[model samples]
Target chain A: NAGVTQTPKFRILKIGQSMTLQCTQDMNHNYMYWYRQDPGMGLKLIYYSVGAGITDKGEVPNGYNVSRSTTEDFPLRLELAAPSQTSVYFCASSYKSGRSSYNEQFFGPGTRLTVL
Target chain B: AQTVTQSQPEMSVQEAETVTLSCTYDTSESDYYLFWYKQPPSRQMILVIRQEAYKQQNATENRFSVNFQKAAKSFSLKISDSQLGDAAMYFCAYYGKGGATNKLIFGTGTLLAVQP
Candidate 1:
């Protein structure tokens, strides 16, 4: 099913520069999320969308923004990229609604970003 | 706030041996979900196993299994017959279904190395 896909597998950005990481899922899931994993650390949530046109901030929402116009696509925007923002970014989707749905999230290959 | 913690920063095991990676989480919600995600060098977040807090029985998938202790707030992953392919960074995540964010909180991760 091709599952979830992320674009630009890797990227390099200069301080103060801006870029967008693309994410899409073939599964018709209602919940999507953006997370960043730093070296020697676990992932921290950046943003999440419960459904189309619905977005909310997660644990680490600073320096990033997200837009969910369609159920399949949710893009993360990095504004004024800094060295601290350099990390592996992952996009995940799950059918996390209702009490009976699945809570397991399917993740993308991930995008490694380096900000200098 | 809910938090996930992986006490071990790194672990090593020989091929065909068994290794257990420990994970503990702090959450007030009684009903929640837990997961173990493996991130190989390719950086794909692969779900290894899952455990629902409400289910007393442990969850197992082939060589991978989980020990879910609700009272202790602990979830550990046991890998039997460890293969080189099993080497990766394992992350423990907690999902509080009762929370408003409905997001997964991840531990720092344990870097697993399988020696052949």
Candidate 2:
């Protein structure tokens, strides 16, 4: 099902440079999320969306913005990239949230970003 | 606030042996979900196992199983007959039902190494 897919497996950006990380999921999930993982560290949430056109900030949302224009796509845009933003980024999606529904998230193959 | 903690940063076991990775979480919510995710060198996050808080029986998937202790807020993953393919960084995550969006909080992860 190509559960979740990310683009630009690796990238290097300079200070103040901006770029967008692409993510797509064909599983028709209603919840989408973006997370970043630093070396030897756990993942931290950056942004998420409950459905198309509705986005919210997560635990670590600075320097990043996200838009969920469609159910299959959620793109993260990094503005004025900084060293702190250099990390591996993952995109994930899940079905509608419910008490009995299976909420297992499907993750993408991550994009490695290096801000110089 | 929900927090997941993985005390062991790294662990090693001989191939075909069993190894357990410990995890502890803090949450006030009674109904929630717990998960173990594996990230291999390819950088894809894969779901290893999951457990629902209300379930009394441990969740098992082939060679992977979880010992879930609700009272102690502990969830540990056990890899039986460990193989080289099982070597990866494992993360414990928590999802509470309090929020409208199902956000996941991940632990600092434990790196497992299967020695031949």
Candidate 3:
């Protein structure tokens, strides 16, 4: 299995620019998430989807939007990007939640975004 | 709100020695999950180990193990026989159940350097 895959390993956007970070997982996981990591910091969730057609905001969702039209894809759209958006973005997938399920997340190679 | 904290910003260990990275969390939910992730220079978020709130026996994966203290709300990762390849940024994360999406709260992270 390809597990989780993210497109454009690196990207740079100028102020007011917009771009969509693409994510896909072949593991057929029901839970998917988007997280951003600033330099020298841990990751913070931006958005997540429980299943197709179901998406929700996470801890940090400003300046971003997400849609889960399919189980395998969850793309994050950044509108009018700013310098604060410069960070490494990661896409992750995990199994369904349960008392017995540890929800061990499988992550994709992150996309390093630099917004000028 | 749940929060994960990694007090150590950086830690160094001899190639053959063992080192423990500290992590503490605060959560109101009784049923939740904790995780340790390793991000190498390649920027891949790899799951190092995980522990369930209800499990008394700490989680272990090969040379990696977690010291989970439920009462104290602490979760620490121990790397045994550290090697150069073990050098990476380690993050502690918390996931509470019953959320619309299984959102994970992550710590600021600790950079681990395994010196020869």
Each candidate's number of clashing pairs is 0, 0, 0
Calculate DockQ per candidate and list them: 0.62, 0.64, 0.61
Error of 1 at B98 (Å): 0.7
lDDT of 3 by residue, B12-48 (tens): 9999999999999998889888999898999998888
Task: Using TM-score, give the best candidate's number.
Answer: 2
Cα error, residue A33 of model 2, in Å, equals 0.4
Clashes by residue pair, model 3: none
Q: How many clashes show up in model 2?
A: 0
CAPRI class of candidate 1: medium
lDDT (tens digit, per residue) of candidate 1 on A4-68: 99998999999999999999999999999999999999999999999999999988899999999
Model 3: DockQ against the native?
Answer: 0.61
For candidate 1, what is the TM-score? Answer: 0.95
Docking class of 2: medium
Residue A19, model 1, lDDT: 98
lDDT string, candidate 3, A13-97, tens digits: 9999999999999988999999999998888989988889999888899999999999999999998999999999999999885
- lDDT for model 3, please: 0.91
lDDT order, best first, reads 2, 1, 3
Shift of residue B115 alpha carbon in model 1, Å: 1.0
To one decimal, what is the Cα RMSD in angstroms of model 1 from the true structure? 1.4
Two-way DockQ contest, 1 vs 2, winner = 2
